[model samples]
Structures are given as C-alpha cells and as structure tokens.
Target chain A: MINTEPSRTRLPAVLATAKNSDGARDEPGEEIPQTISPIRTFLMGRSSGAGVDLLFYGVMVLCAVSIFVIVLAIIFVLFQNSALSRHQFGFTFFKGQDWDPVSGLFGAWPFIVGTLLSSLIALVIAVPLALGVAIFVTELCPKFLQGPISFLTELLAAIPSVVYGLWGIFVLVPLVRDHVGPFLLKYLGWTGLFGGLNIGVGLLTAGIILAIMILPVISSLTRDVMRAVPTSQREAVLALGATRWEMIRTGVLRNARIGIVGSIILGLGRALGETMAVTMLIGNRAEVPHSLFSPAHTLASVIANEFSEATGDLYLSSLIEIGLALFAVTIVVNAIARLLIWAVTRGAPARVA
Target chain B: MAIEPAGVSLPDNTPGPVPASEPKSTGPGRNRNVLRSVIDHSVTGLSILATVVVLAPLVAILGYLLFKGFSSLNFAFFTQAPRPVGEAGGGMANAIVGSGIVLAIASAIGIPVGIGAGVYLAEYGRNGVFANFVRFTADVLNGVPSIVMGIAAYSLIVVRQHHFSAMAGGIALAIMMVPTITRTTEEMLATVPGAVREAALGLGIPKWRTTISVALRTASPGIITGCMLAFSRVAGETAPLLFTAFGNQFWSVKLGQPIAALPLQIYIYAVSPYDEWHRLAWAGALVLIVLIMASVTLVRIFAGRGVLKGNS
Candidate 1:
C-alpha cells in the first residue's frame, strides 16, 4: 500500500513467488525453473540472517560465561577445603577480639574493626575537605589560581599508595609519636581512643594516612560532579544576593548531593582496599583495640602480611575468605555508587521534560 | 501611585538626596562588613590549609629522601650490589634490571588483551546487557586486592611450577595490569568519537580494520598513557611479587629464576636491622619515587595533550 521504488518491489515479489510456488506445486518440472529463479535466490539470502544473530549472541554469551567463571572460581576455591571454613567458635571469629597466628588461633575482629574504622575516619575527613576544595576551585577561587590549584589537587592522586606508606612510616609516624600523640593523650586522656601509650603506629595513624590517600579521589570526583551542575542554578542564587559560599551551599551542594555521596563512597571503597600504606603504619597487631590509638590490623593488611606464610588448609582458606569478604564489600559499594549516580542523572530527564 | 510587586522599581529620586547623610553613619557598618569578609576569607584560607596538611608530608618525605639519597647516588650505586651489614657502598643494579624485565613482560602480556577487550567494549558493545556485565566485572576486578591477585598467581602459577620464578611475578603483575589497562583503554576508546568509526566504515573498510586503523590510531596516545600508568602502579607492587618472584640477590635475566625488584628490595632492606641495608633501602626508595613520579608525569602530559587535541 505504501509507495516504493520498483527495484525494492523486485526482491519481495520474488520471495513471495517462491513461497507460493513451493506451497502449491510438487512437480519436478516446476522445481527446476523455480530453483534457478530470483525468488529462490531471495529466499536463500534471508535464511542467512540468523547467522548474524548467532555471532552477536555468541560473543555476548562468552563474556557472560567469563564473569560467571570468575565468581565460581573464587567461591569454589575458597569453600572446597572445609578445614579452612571452620571458625568453629560460633561467630567468635568476628567477635573474639584477638588474632594470635603463632598459637594457631585466628580471629578477624581487629582487622574488621581496623578496616571499617579507618575507612569511616577517611570518609569523615575527606568528604568535607573535598567539598570545600571543589567549591573553592569551582566558584570562589580567582581564574588564574584555578588551573594550578586544581592540577596540584589532582596530582595528589598520582602518588602511589606505597609512597604514602613510606612517607607515613618515616615522617607521619615520628611526628604523631613525638608531638601529636602525647599532646592528645595529655589533653584527651579521658577518651579511651586517645588513652593508649604513644606507639607511633596505631589505628589513628592508619586512619590519617588513609584520609590523605583517599582525599584526591574524593576531591576529583566532587569537582567533576560540581562542574556538571548547570550555571543557571548559580546565577539564580546570585541574583537573590547570595554570597559565593551561600550560593554554593544552597545551589551547588543541593544539586550535587547524591553525586557527592557517590564520590565519598567511592573514596571509602578505596580506603577499605588500601594495603601497603596501612600495613606499614598500622603496627600489624591482630588484637581488637579498646582504643583508636591502639595498634591493629586491617583485612587488606592481614592478607598482605600473611598470605605468603599461610600454609595448611585452614590458614589458606581463611585468607581466601578474607579476599571474598573484600570482593563482596567492593561490589556492594560499587552497587551503591551506581544507584546514586542513577538517582542523580535520572532527575535530568524529568527536569527537561 | 501604588505599584504591583512585579512592576515595582526603586524610588531613585527619593533615595539619592538622603544618601550622603546615611552614608556617613554606614562607615562603622562597613567596617563590620569588612571584618566579616576577613573572617570569611580566613575560613577559605583554613580550607587551603587542610589541603596543605594533606600534601605537606609527601613534600617533606620527597625532600628528605632527595637530600639523603643524593650523597649515595653515584655510578657505583647504579652498578654494584649491596655490601655487607657494616660495609660502606652498594647499589641496586640487579633490582632495577629485574623490575624492568618484569614490567616489560607484564606489558607484553597485558597490553594486547586489554586493548582487544576494550575494542570489543567500545565498538561492538552497543550498550547492551552484556556490555553492562563486562563493565561491572571490570569494576570488580579493579577492586580485587593486589595481594589477592598475588595469591591467585601464586596458586595458579608458582605452586604448579614448584618454585618461585620471575615468570610468576610477571603473571601476577600482569593480572594487576589487566584491570587497570582495560579500564583505561575502554575510557580512551570511548573518547574516540563514533563519527571517526563511521567514516572509516563508510570508506569501505571492514569494522575490524576501521577499529584498528582509525579508532586505535586516534586513541594511541591515551592508550600509551594508560599503559604507563599501569606500569607505574605495578612497578611498586611488592606483595604480589613477594611469594612468586621470591627476591634474588644475584644478577638474573632468566625468567624461570627468582628476581629482585626495587619495591621488594626496598621492603626487605628497610625492614632489616643493618645500617648499610637501610641506606640501600633509602636509595631504592628514592629510585622508585623518581620512576613513579616520572612515569606519572609523562602520562599526564601525554594524556593532557591528547585531550586538548581531541577538543580542538
């Protein structure tokens, strides 16, 4: 019914003719001419379309299979040896508050506590600092200073975590041990977190080191998200006589809240997975500390410290379990990040619409 | 006359005559405002202070290392092995060569797979469900602890081989390199416009040819930068190499034998009680910092140039 070129009609008509003739006649004489016809060629050509679909799906299936394989390999390898799975003390592995590998007793409480506590500390420190830096660079800073300031901030990200660890051991640990730790202990001794003897290597030092390591990640992400906020929002706030800080607080932060949260969580994830720096400065004690100033271990530090020495079934399995724990945590964090990004970007269409 | 709220304007005639008398009393208020502005500026200055606190330790460490490391940096330091515990002079030549060999091997193994996978993602993916899955897996892989990669490589390669080897070290480093390289490659490829791909296809080139010839050509600088970043990251990785490579003291070019690297050497020496060893550790740390800083700086410069060109 639709208008079309005669050349386009030729193929479909041939296909139709072939279909009709094949259905109506069975004679050998009729088959020969029909086989040689354009209609037969058209029918043969369309049959190969499924081949294209097969190739596309084939590659997709392979990728899917690989993902499943990786997950399975991790799970199977961790669980295949049952001796490693027996933390038989009934939730004691998580809550036992001690790790004496020398006595063959392994509890992850200190590591769990250290990892979570440090990451939390990092998030608390970095989120505000990052937001302030982002706001300053985006809005308050002079145009000439913006380039250098932003570049320096991002350059912090390029320094490897090992360098941070090395620096912490040499410089940060000494400074904390000599001046900061003693001062804090003298003033804030009532608080258990500051009550411990100055060992120079403790949860607080690890947290501070992590905070520095994660700062650039948080700031860079925050900057990107803040930059994406449309200029009109800022103009509207300024038109109402809002100061630069006030405008950023009301307009930019309000809009970038979800993105900023995502950025913070991303930094948190980095803090959690940090290995070398924490291991170097954390004193590597396996005891769950009653105070933040007490030496402790992290999951990453534990694996880094003991994976080589981890012989026998239980030791190896426990370490793999730790890896699984890390993997699960990372996946969960990324999922949260993805959800936050989706929530923020999803508002765009509604606003446009 | 009464005016509507939307149409209201300032009474210019009434305000102008009263301004001189009012302005005289506003001086004190202006000073108060100035004080408030100073407070605000100081708060902003405090934020910069926080940034400085975060950055200062890195600077101080570098300065200390540079100052101390310079006295030891000589031709002999580059070529000689460590002296005994109390001995005077030694170098990290073997460590440097081992690191170079491992990095070269890791790059050779990782770059092709990473680039090919990235090509598959950017060109053929089409934002399909499979692409999303690949992306998520890549994220997970990136998050996998470096030590875990070390463990995996140890189990899969070193244990089977029944001995530590540089090949095992290279494989472990390669695993670490893959996720980084893949992520960077995908990002770089994504930055290459679709129009370039289409243009190549329109000119009768096959999809594979178009991807390799045009898209990859455009993304090469970015790809190289990514590779360099991956190299910098893996070069300093000690945990993975600890068990697999199992540090060597003698000069070793053999892939099957254990090897020494700058990070492992630094770690071992730093932890040891010997004063001479500690000095070597400092020297190794200095070499490492220089290498990392240099590679990262180079990549940033190259990547920035690529981005500038892309924008233009």
Candidate 2:
C-alpha cells in the first residue's frame, strides 16, 4: 500500500514503517491510533482521497443545517396552511371565545385560557413539589438512597404521555371524583374554584395529572442546575458551621434559583402543550370553565381531538391556525427557558445524557 | 448551625430566617441556636414531604396498572386483533407490529440525522453563530407540542398523499425524536475528551475518521442509550399518530396504509364507551408501560452512572 505513495509525509512514513502493538516488533500499519490506519496508507499518493472525508463532513453539516431548515419549513407550512383562518379572523385571531363551526366563527380564547389555567395550576403544584424532590435528592437524601431515588424520580419523565392519560382516566379521575373533589367542595367551596358539580374529568383533574407528568422534567432539570452549583459553595457554607438545611438554602438553592425558575418554566411549557392525558381528563369542552372542576379544552388537546374529523376548509384552517399559535408560543417559551437555563449553567453540559 | 447548645430547650413556632443578632445573653443565644435548628429541621421536613407528594401518584398509578392489567392479560390478548363489539377475547397484536414498523422507520430517519447533527454540533459547531442558531432551534423544537407535529405531518405527507399512513406517522415520530437524539448525542460526544481527538489528528487520521471511529466509538454507549431514550419516548406517542397512522382496527402492515400503534390504540379504546375496549386499553397500556419501563430503567441506570466520570 505504501508503494503507491509519491511524496514523503511524516504520517505515511510512520504508518508504513511503525512498530506493532508490543511497541518493539515492527509491523506496518499495525499501530492504529499509535500509528495510522492502513487505510490511510493505501490512499497516500491520491491525496484527493479526502473525498470520503469531505463527503462525511458535508453530510454532517447538511444534517445540522437541516435542523434549521426543518424549523423554517414548519413555520412556513403552519403559516401557509393557516392562511385562510389567519386572514378571516384577522391578526387578533386569538381574541374571542366563540368557536361555532356551524356559523364559521372561530377564536382561540377559550383554548388559550384552558391551557393557561391548567398549566398555571400544574406550575402551582409542581414547583414546590419538584423543588422539594430536587432538594431531597441533591442535598438531604442518605448516601445509600440517593442513586436509587434519583433514578426513580427521573423514571417519571420516561413514562409515555398516553399511558399517563390512561392512568388518569381510570385511577386519577376516580380519586379526584370520590375523595379530593368532594373534600374540596365541602371545605373550599367558598373560593369558587372547586364548587362546580364534579364529573370526575375537568380542568383541575387535568391540572393534577399534568403536575404529575411535568414533575420529572422540573425536578431533573432543577437537580442538574443545583448539582451545577459548585461544591465549594456548599463546603464554604458548611465551614461556617451551618446546618444541612441552612447550607442548602444559603449555598445551593440561592445559587440555583434562576435555573430552578427556568426548569419550572420548561415544565410549564410541557404542561401547556401536553395533549393525550389532558385530552382524556379535561373533557374536551370548548367553553372556558367557570370553575376548575368544570370541563374545558386546551389548545393542544383541542387540536388532537378535532383535527382528525375537521371537514370544512375553514374548520381545518382554524385548527391548523390554533396549532400554529401553539407552535409559536411553545417555541418562544422554550427559547426563553433555554436562555435562562443557559445563563445559569453558562454552557456547561447538562447531566441529561 | 448545630449551635445546638444541647442543654437548651425552646418551643417557638415563628417562621422566619434566624435573627442576624442574638440577644448576646447566653440564654437568648441558646434559644436562637435552638431556633436555627428548628428552622433547619422544618425545611428538611417540607422537602421530604414534597418528595412524598411527587412519588405517591407514581406508586398509585403503577400499582393500579399492575392490578388491573395483569389480571386481564391472556393468550388472545397478545395474538389476536380486536374482536368486533361484543366478543370477549382479543389483543393489540396488530398495533404492536405497526408500532414496530413505525419505530423502525423513525429510527432509520431520526437516529442518523440526529447523530450526524450532534456530531457536527460537538465537533464543528463550537463557536459559530450558525451553530448557536442550530442549538437554540433544537431546544425550541424539542419543546414543540406533539399534536402540532401531528398537524405538520398531516399537512406535509398525509394530505399530500391523500391518506393516513404509517409512513406519515413514522415521519411525525421521527421529527419528535430528533431534538432529543441530537441533544443527547451532542452531550455524550462532548464528554469524549479533546485530547483523544488531538491524538488521532496527531497520528495523521483525517478529522472525520477520527470523529466517526474514535470519538463515536468511545461515546457509543451513551449515544446508544440516547437513541433508546428517543425510541422509548416515541413509542408511546398517540397525539402524533392520531391523524397520521390514524389507528387501524385490524392488522395492516403496508407503509401506505393506516396502521395501529400501542399508544394510539390505547387512546382510541380509552375514550370509547365500552367496557371491553376499556379492558383492552388497560392491557395495552400495561404492555406499553412495561416495554417503556424496561428501556427507561436502562436509561436511569446509565444516566445515574455519570457516563463521563473519569474522562472529564
């Protein structure tokens, strides 16, 4: 293979004449990263042989560039398909609450409201619980229990959304209807949020389900951020003779708060866009629920429930426009969360891998 | 502060940070010490309570699923299709097969593009603006709702082809899988030390060759687990498959034909007002969760191990 070489490059000389694995015996091309691959020697004279190398690089660049293209194409497709609704409904398409397709009136208001309220409820429940879980796993857990507990917490994120939906249908819905709902009704009815007749499936049910669904996302990211807090900070606080909780609150939580907020927002993004579980649990109504116990439809669930059978062009266009709005909102929210997380982590590779 | 002053005992229920200034009298100082311990212990209790609140639902759901689904599983549940309205015994065999096919196509498309993009981001996209653009886009894209992706697939392929097909469903799932795969791959690859790359370069190996054979091989385990993560996540997607695969009732394997998937079938059954279908949905869900949990368990183990440990 080396006989084909025209010029002398140090690589070719090292490859064709290098010692073998023992580092003492001489065998050409036997020392790989120690020497060069025999394949390199075979193409020595034809330096144009970089064609394969260049092609591989080009393909990778193309694939990377395709991510940009895919996002653009999605934005274009959503906007193009949503044109009719975007035009007829005008720029304020998200304003009104009416969605009567029989008369062709469509507005994103109710869906937006449902998405907001349910996600906000999820955030309200998830943030503290997730933070506690993160803190427990990161700071307070016993050495023997930490690994298993962390693994169990992350496993929550791995469960499918559809399965969560099924569980919500059978298990959660009954629990809410039989116990939690009546209890809230008897005790907290004056607040007006839990007063409606409980049918077992409603915004609050979906919210609770969503809280469970987003818990892993929030806690995992929060854990990573907290873990990213330099160990020195913890040591410094401890050196001051602070208690475990005091050290954690002062050294870890305070440092990790920004990223924790970021993680919560990311969880909120998941809750807002979650489909199957919410669809199964939220009752798929178009109305804005007067009480959290009442039924409602979210932007994502609305799309999932309606898009399949939407026949009229206007109806289809409106659905796509709703999807477009969801696409844009989630993207912006996620981008903001990413920025905040990036600010906290400062480009350090997150432990998500 | 363990300023426990072990002899001091105080019963205070005030909720605030420890006062900056102690009364300086040993009596007040000791009380303040007890106050600090009280606050510390209470915060620990709250956090533990938080952990319990989060985990209780998980245990309840998994336990109920086991109770309901295990009792319902039968031979027919794995080997047969849904027997029309009244018949008692049938399985999601077709949906299982369809899910396999769709996942194959998704893995075919998603893994390569995702890993290739990840390779670029880690190796070449270090400082460039375009790389940052790609990174930001990947994060945002990861957060894009699955239903929206379903609509995109419906518009791009289903509408154009004039039918729901497994291929369209596969494409939708593939798109969803990309951001995750890309991110995981990039992170895993980043953990491959640069000195290794420099060594390969020093040995006169081409940059691409060093990346593929050297870096990728070193990072393969993490990357493989990353792909599995994407696979398991996509396996349970119902929203993306709603209009794309469209959830067939009977067996259909052709790429062009609508196909059933485990998640989609479970969804259809769960929403239907039939006791029999409800049972099947439970069984199907049980199967899906079991399958997903197996892979998830792998991820949990690998992820918890801190894959880059000594390399970094």
lDDT, residue A291, model 2: 93
Predicted candidate 1 versus true structure: per-residue lDDT over A1-353, tens digit per residue: 45567546455555555667544543333223323455446445544445554564455345444543554554455444323544454356666665665666667777898899878877777777777777666666555667887777766776666666766877788988999888888888777668757789888899888988888888877776776666667667656644445556787789989988988888888888888888888888877777777888898888888877777666776776676677678768877876786667655533422
Number of the top-ranking candidate, with lDDT as the measure: 2
lDDT scores of the candidates, listed in order: 0.72, 0.84
Candidate 1: regions farther than 4 A off? A1-76, A79-83, A86-91, A341-353, B1-39, B300-312
Query: Could you estimate the TM-score for every candidate?
Result: 0.81, 0.88
**What TM-score does prediction 1 earn?**
0.81
Best by DockQ: 2
Give the per-residue lDDT of model 2 (tens digit) for B101-197.
9999999999999999999999988769988889888887788899999998889899899999999999999988898989989998998899999
Listed per model, the TM-scores of chain A against the true chain A are: 0.77, 0.87
Q: Number of clashes in every candidate structure?
A: 0, 1
Error of 1 at A118 (Å): 2.6
- Residue-by-residue lDDT tens digits, candidate 1, B265-293: 87777656776776677778888878888
Q: Quick one: best TM-score, which candidate?
A: 2
